[model samples]
Target: MPDGDVNAHRRIPRPAWDVINQLALRRCTDETHSVRFRRGSEITRWTLAELDQRAVNLARRLHATGVRVADRVGVLSTNRIEWVLLDLAVLKLGGVTVAVEPGRFEPERVIEKYGLRRLFAEGETSRDAVQDIDSVLSLTEPPGTDVPELPAFPGYDEADICQIKQTSGSTGTPRGIETTAVSVNSSISEVQELFRHGDGDNILVLLPLWFLQQRWWFYSALVFGHDVALSGYEDAVEMAQAVSPTVVMGVPRLYDDLRARIRASGAPVDLPERRETIQALLGGRIRYLWTGSAPATRATLEFFNDAEVPLYEGYGLNETCIVAKNHPGAFRLGSVGQVLPNKTIRFDRDGVLVIASHHPVNTRYTWCNPGDNQKVWLPTGEIKTYDLGHVDDDGFLWIHGRVDDVISPSAGPNVLLPPIETLLRGLPGVHECAVYGRAVRFLTAIVSPNPDLDPAVLSDRIVALNETLRPEQRVHAVIVAAEQFSVRNGLLNTQFKLKRRQIEERFARELELVYDKHNGDAAPPVPPVLVFG
Candidate 1:
């Protein structure tokens, strides 16, 4: 344990060796449902013993493939039991696991950066450059090991790097985050103490394994003796209903999808009953939900909570993994809640949140080599987070906008767009809205309103919103989206956050029209422009 740090309440023993060694010491009571996940069309369940043996067997296979200790291994796959199995196998062999986002497939960069020699690419087209993973799992695979006897678990030290996590690229290029066994294990222990998750808790994990929260849930589950049910976006609701998971972890987009479904189902008409039904649909035992990555709509938070399933928002980034969260003891509606135990937070000169973690964290980006310690951190170990926020007197953290996103309009006053867009989401017929500016004089908006809204009515609403803003900050004009921004379209990411640069480029012509109308001699047609700048 580090000096000046205390974990008086962390009951579950922090890893003496690594999590794998501790789990190896754990004795299953015949009631532990360690893992439950679906293969292509079949479901598989693994008990604690079975899960351990599989990792042990897989560890031998990994070693046979020439995976030396401290070697880097890449995994590019969707969420599945294999991802977990391979991760454990690599750790048991004292290797590093690097998660590469599937579909985007940037293996060359990851390989070059991390010096990776092997890659486990499941369900992917064989690239000529990397080793293909052979241990593709199926539902029919028997409980017993099919491989040779288990080798000595090339045990790892607490300081050995075990995982490399990539950011969501919310602001810029996704930076790879490195972590050691001590940090990862300590993190699981910290969260376990906060939530008190135990054997009775069945966690439904919907986000892909590449996501930070998804990996955190899995790590916490195996060590904490909880069961994890894995499912994709398409089957999450159905699986949740069947699994009856006690907790669910996901991004804000998931709740948005559910809220949309409930609206279509007319469930909110009866708040109490609707809450029960909805929670049941999401696996009735859901005590409270975990959400982060992006800002969740206030309407979504209030809707689920009003119905009984409290949606708790938290804050963290790729750099500082799980820094603060809103738990049952301390929760504020729009805030990301209080900083977690073993952490200290303060604001920088520009109101950017600076964080100091008592737990071990990677100090620099291995690939890019961010900067020297003095420049990257404060004297107290608080690292500067580009996220702009303020802590209230009550100790709750409230995010305002991205420091880089504080738009300075050459034509007028500064504008903060997140709040404006957040307000627009509450409007009657607006399904989604994205406000845009920068490299331009005034603000412009690209709105995706509910299809049922009357064009005339929506136009009026946009005009009404404009009246509330100043000349420089007001949305100069609105362009109603022909379709919802989607990940496939390159306008949105997997988290449902607008890819600002992509959206601006995609709507460059429309944006030009908005500014042209704002400053040009003639009005660039009404109604089509929606609202004038």
Candidate 2:
């Protein structure tokens, strides 16, 4: 069967609500347009028609099992074709799909909190997490013909809440955010125009499918008729080699680690050769890379750009989808890029960035901690972001740090931690770092060094970093953390943002020691600063 040349011939863009019909049309007419994924040694491909059929079948089965319109159905799984199928199936039945991370949050709690009647668990871990649930189903189940046929498109409205998701919580707790079909569809439309995704373009999704952005890429594939290869972090590089993907969407940590690995491989001295090497490292058909969710170090960004690979960084939240992004046609080196067409951003008097959209994804939290709603949602229909940043004259958005993360040292002036922490992360031997100083004479840092980094080298790097900073912003001493900060340790959130308050409390004594040592000549001895390679 030949690939249907529908995109070039279409006169009107179909809304996301019509995605099932579109898939049916494509499957029957455009046979070659399909979703592809890898699982272990086997690879599976499902045509648009096949995908739509499976979704319809699943929807019928779900309906028979008492799942109804507006019911919240939980999906806890890894990145696989089944996840997409289940998502489509739920949408077809006009049910809201609640995406839940398998290990990060307790499944029972989420089920009770969201009033989910049933859960679709894929992997063993996810299944185990919901063992006690009354109506847990397997996402890996094959489509059955026993159920009656369902309507191709149910009574789904664009304004109805179709999904509930939580952005990575820096506070170690998930806050559910409501999403509508209109918002998701609008986002896809904006992205399609901004990036111009077409045939032969494949976006390799390495992040968990539970994330909204990852699923957005999948929906885009269905709408624009491109390929999307889903894989876990462990097999991202291997899967890339197999698929030769043109676009790879990932978090900043993945890029940072890749940069480190490239440098470790003894990169070429020549710039062109280095660029070629980097491209070849990722299967040789590279178009561009997308990074967000956390800050990518200057060194990591520079490394890819210096190699001539454009790494596009975007800014958004679960509450606001994508606010701004750096695309192929327009970009600024240090900025997240110009605000998207529908969204507008402005800075407050205190330098906090606030966002307002004509069609906001959400206006209130579906589930969150107490008082969280009043803090962010304003009467003007603008979201008051606590992030401190400024827009350049040309409208490029540059983020400095969170407003609350400012370190007010007693003596000279206040300092922003993110920019400094970004610099420290780029320093050799430092894997991760957090800078802090509150009503103190000098700033102190908690450093997580690479295992192979030498202590002497780290000391030298810190000294060199201080030379480039203002007197007040310089870190006077560092307390080397015993372990790397990660989601498992409660030091970092799911999105890789540092839990500043938790990290500070976790190492209170060491911080106190470093502060006391730098206070005066008669203070206690300074803790040894150990650096890892």
lDDT for 294 (candidate 1):
84
Query: Candidate 2 residues 2-99, lDDT tens each?
Result: 12221233344343344423432333334666667875588777776666666666677778878887888888777777778778777777788899
In candidate 2, stretches whose alpha carbon ends up further than 4 angstroms from where it belongs are 1-30, 122-145, 152-155, 168-170, 522-533
After superposing all C-alphas onto the true structure, candidate 2 shows an RMSD in angstroms of: 6.8
Report the backbone clash tally of model 1.
1
* Residue 64 Cα positional deviation in candidate 1, in Å, after optimal superposition: 2.1
* Candidate 2: residue 197 lDDT (0-100): 78
Give the alpha carbon lDDT tens digit for every residue of 1-533 in model 1.
Answer: 12232333444344332554554334334346677888767787878567756676676666765777778888888777888777776776777888888765466766776678677786445564364455445321443454444455545566667788776444445567677666666666667767888778888888778765576676666666778788876688888987888888877878887887777777658898878777867877888888988898898898888887888998876666777788888888999988876566766666777776665567765554344344455555567777787788888889987876788766566788888888777666666778877656656678765666566776677677767866665665677778777777787777667788877777778778777666453432333357421
Model 1 clashing residue pairs (backbone): 476-533
State which candidate has the highest lDDT.
2
Using TM-score as the measure, the top candidate is 2
